[model samples]
Target: MAMKHFTIQDAATMYGVKEWGYGFFGINSKGHLEVYPTRDENLSCDIHEVVTHLHKKGIRTPVTLRFPQILATRVTELNEAFHKAMKEYDYEGDYQGVFPVKTNQIKEVVDHIVKAGYKYRYGLEAGSKAELMIALSMNLHAEALVTCNGYKDESFIRIALLALKAGRNVLITVEKMTELPLILKVAKELKVEPLLGLRMKLNAMGSGKWESSAGDHAKFGLNTQEILDTVDTLERRGLLDSVQELHYHIGSQITDIRKIKAAIKEATRVYAKLVKRGVPLKYLNVGGGLGVDYDGSRTTFHSSMNYTMEEYAADVVYTTKDICTQEQVPVPNLLSESGRAIVAYHQVLVVDVIGLIDTTHTKYRVELSGQEPQILKELAYTRDNISVKNFAEMYHDAITQKDELITLFNLGYLGLDDRAKGEILFWEVCRKLSRILSYKSLKYIPEEFQDLNKSLADKLIANFSLFQSMPDHWAIDQLFPVMPIHRLKEKPTLSATLCDITCDSDGKVEKFIDLKDVRDEIPLHEPKSGEPYYLAFFLVGAYQDTLAMRHNLFGSVNEAHVIVNEDEDFRIQQIVPAQTTDDVLKSVHYDPDELVEGPTRRRKISANSDANEALKTALTEQRKLHTYLEMN
Candidate 1:
């Protein structure tokens, strides 16, 4: 037998980097994961170096690494794809995109998007009052559109009206007919003609998890009759001229391009009908459904998209052009709130493997003094006779004998020693079955042993909390690509499942993304004691940060903003430290001052000896420390 050696290319293929990374991520010859900011550049930045630098600077494990260069690149790729599509189709109107702030409301994330997307005049889309305030604070380009979406109140409408009066291209989309009067009233009070848009509830729906964002029974948007009634009300008031944009969102993370094309055709027809009624709609806002291929399978799965950005843009442009030309209406300006597509690749959640738990650590062989139970002897025989050729039959026999051994022990016929031997023998059989299943030449694993890998996988306890980092995986079963950041040049011989540091039983990631299907476990190398092994969850920039919860009082992890230099080296622009114990207490309406003062007073009253004083000092230091576990 010969030991097979694996290369960096094998790591790339195993992790689906070429498909999901979109050329920004790869492994270098040094076995470190590298970030290539630009496709034309030959230079690369090692992600391991970034982590090492952060560690040197006192930033611990479970730090999020933000690559602003990737954000800029994605924004450029999205806009350029549309621009190329418009040119090829000879489309009359231009393409405009606004990032929905709800996808990631972090100030740094929004700032990076605004900075990177300036060339494309990319703007912000606010779905709430708080989000609108953030959007209004940004100094967007003069031509950039500020889209005000979601359910609005009087204050929301007033703010939108003020933004419009301030010469911003603000579009207040009416989700329901009830919102139209609020816009009109706010506009009349401010004596400013507001830019109004209607979000139509299209009959055509999108595909994937969020397809409910549109369709007849959607949560937002006005029905056909409600839209007509609103239009008539505006027309009677001579305010139909204010209706300058038509908006419709099929869903978020739409995986199928055909669904996008169908939605575009339907929305364009709605735009043409509105124009025929003398509404003079100039903007057709195709609300965001642009998806990222998280699994990199290129299939129409919930986790991955079937089409490319260029294909999406081409279909959007050509469909709108064809529909408008048939209806003899002008090609309206195209606007998309593609938040997920723009930000999904901009951040990676890095966590270190603190330790591994091996389930098959116990030796199975037992010393029998010729007085062992018949059932225990049979289980031992099955374990000894287990081989690849007869693993299935031997496993079944072991299971039956183990069950009989447990029954005999409960009936007082077998002693604890015999029962222990039986259990060990069963686990040894499982271990041998898993080893046989791992043969490289094996094509298909039997259904009975399909879960053998999961059973034998090493449970890697990670330092990060799943609730605070990847909420989608916990809440919606979303798959994020997780891979080792280093040791790519070596072969990963162990299958592992990641268990977070949280106390909740649900705080573990067992499902992983694969090229052809979902993987039950991730391939990982055997951890060397006293050495740090790091893994990263990729394409988590969208909806993760904002959606993270404070489960078990675990707050936000430390964040490192990495900027790529001209020489392709990296620099940490900023580091946001994780929340302290006081921060978590304050969030839950606890007074930190009162807590500290009470603890101090109690310590003083109870401190009569040197040991008590030392305990008080230790308690004070513990109170100031962060909530997460500190790795030794």
Candidate 2:
């Protein structure tokens, strides 16, 4: 309400688009957000066009748009960053990267990453038997490597060995000492020597929420003594040549460069010592911790990364080379599992804001009659008298009088008409106080007044289940960039928090990404009636897809794979429809036909033939529809 001159530059800055876009997301001259797949403004596609195209094909909002070009570009950037770093550092070993399939096991996403990086000899990392199947099926280059991580059962080990015998470079990293004996036995039984690895528990700790992924008490990996004992056992068995990779993962979404440098140095020291001991280690697998700055603050915050891909690659290459040089050992071929950085920018979830819940009571006036209750009159006065000078005191007075009005109503002393008026007056007081303080504080608004914004702002009811789309936000408070995908040229005069269409109260997002701090409400344009106002949630490709829940029985959203053509135009490559209600019910072990049996029996017995026919059609359609709130 205070600022009249808002430019596209202001919108970009407000949303941190340029900071976190990584040259892939930006606003175009037409006031719509565009995807610059090639990092050139001339070669971009309007995201709104992608959504409209999908709409024309019978798909509605609450669809996940996948930019395969973005995924491909990220793969190239990561490998090229490491290559450039290795070149500058004069490192002897080659750089080969693997995308851990656990981040996003979607077929299209994985296929694109592999195809994009096939030239650079990129491969997939599997942590379980199912993912191992994905890796073996990948048309990976003959020289590309597939590294097996996580705890391995006999079945998991057998598949790795079979692949190795079939001429695929598969490295099985032993997380526990017991897994080593199984690997040795399985190799002996199959008569095919297994290329092995050791998941070392690093002495150094990474930074951010998952820092414990590498330290002494890490969930997996071998400790120092265990590593030595495994090496000794391999040496005694004459299998030293089979040990090919020494892998270590600090964590996922590492935020600090110092932690990465320290961890790499430690990992290389161990690799060099093993090489000196005649273990023939050739690959130093640095596990996936490359972070994507979802918030674009470039700080050490959990949601942000202080370092760039260039800096991360440089630190990794230089640190490894430096440590190897100190120990007089040749540098090992490098491999990284940076899954988050590779896939986070490749997907955007667009949900429609179907309705608005505004409680500001803009039409309410304090024209109370003389017969009104004393407390109601007091709240009306507070609403009328709030100002920049006396707003703080009037805010406190409004709170007191509003509470008394509620008490009077509960005690049967106040009528419904007067009670409703008092409720209107309380929210009006909040709105007036907020406007008065908006221009005064500039920076240091009191906490109470800052929270007043949420109380006065509208609650936009979006048509997607937060629990089904983004579980991390609810489970870990992770922030994803959320804003209107179109209408950037128009100044947003309304502010609101987003709520999904779930019955649970936790299925809402009040905290939003900001440059300076976490924002309580997002600046939004007023929604036009009968039109779907869409908001795109950015950087949700990593871990959100698989971690989503079926809370309230809401199924997955439709997925759109968007690829740019030769002239940098738009085209929908493929569409994956969401699970139908019947499908979801079957997943939960519910038989649709059985559930409809009683209704069908009742219809058959009834005399209203037309109504029964309508009921049958409705049941058929309802069973086939998606579980999300269908918007018109």
Best by TM-score: 2
Report, for all candidates in order, the number of backbone clashes. 0, 0
TM-score of 2: 0.97
All models, RMSD in angstroms = 2.1, 1.8
Displacement of the residue 301 alpha carbon in candidate 1, Å:
0.8
Q: What is the C-alpha lDDT of each candidate?
A: 0.87, 0.88
lDDT of 1 by residue, 462-551 (tens): 999999999999999999999999999998978889999888889999999998999999899888888899999999999899888999
Q: Estimate each model's TM-score.
A: 0.96, 0.97
Evaluated against the true structure, the overall lDDT of model 2 is 0.88
lDDT of 2 by residue, 1-632 (tens): 67567778888988889988878898877788888886767778888888988898899879999989888889989999999998998998999998899999999889998999999999999999999999999989888889999988999999999999989999898999999889989999999998988889998998998987678789999998998999999889888888889999889889999989989988888899888888898899988899989888999999999999999999999999889889999999998999999999989999998888866776566678878988888988888888877877888898888889999999999999989889998988888777777785655666777677877778889999999899999999999999888889988878889999989999999999987788889999989988778899999999999999999899999989888765547888999999888988998999888766657674446677687668777877889888887778
- In terms of TM-score, how similar is model 1 to the real structure? 0.96
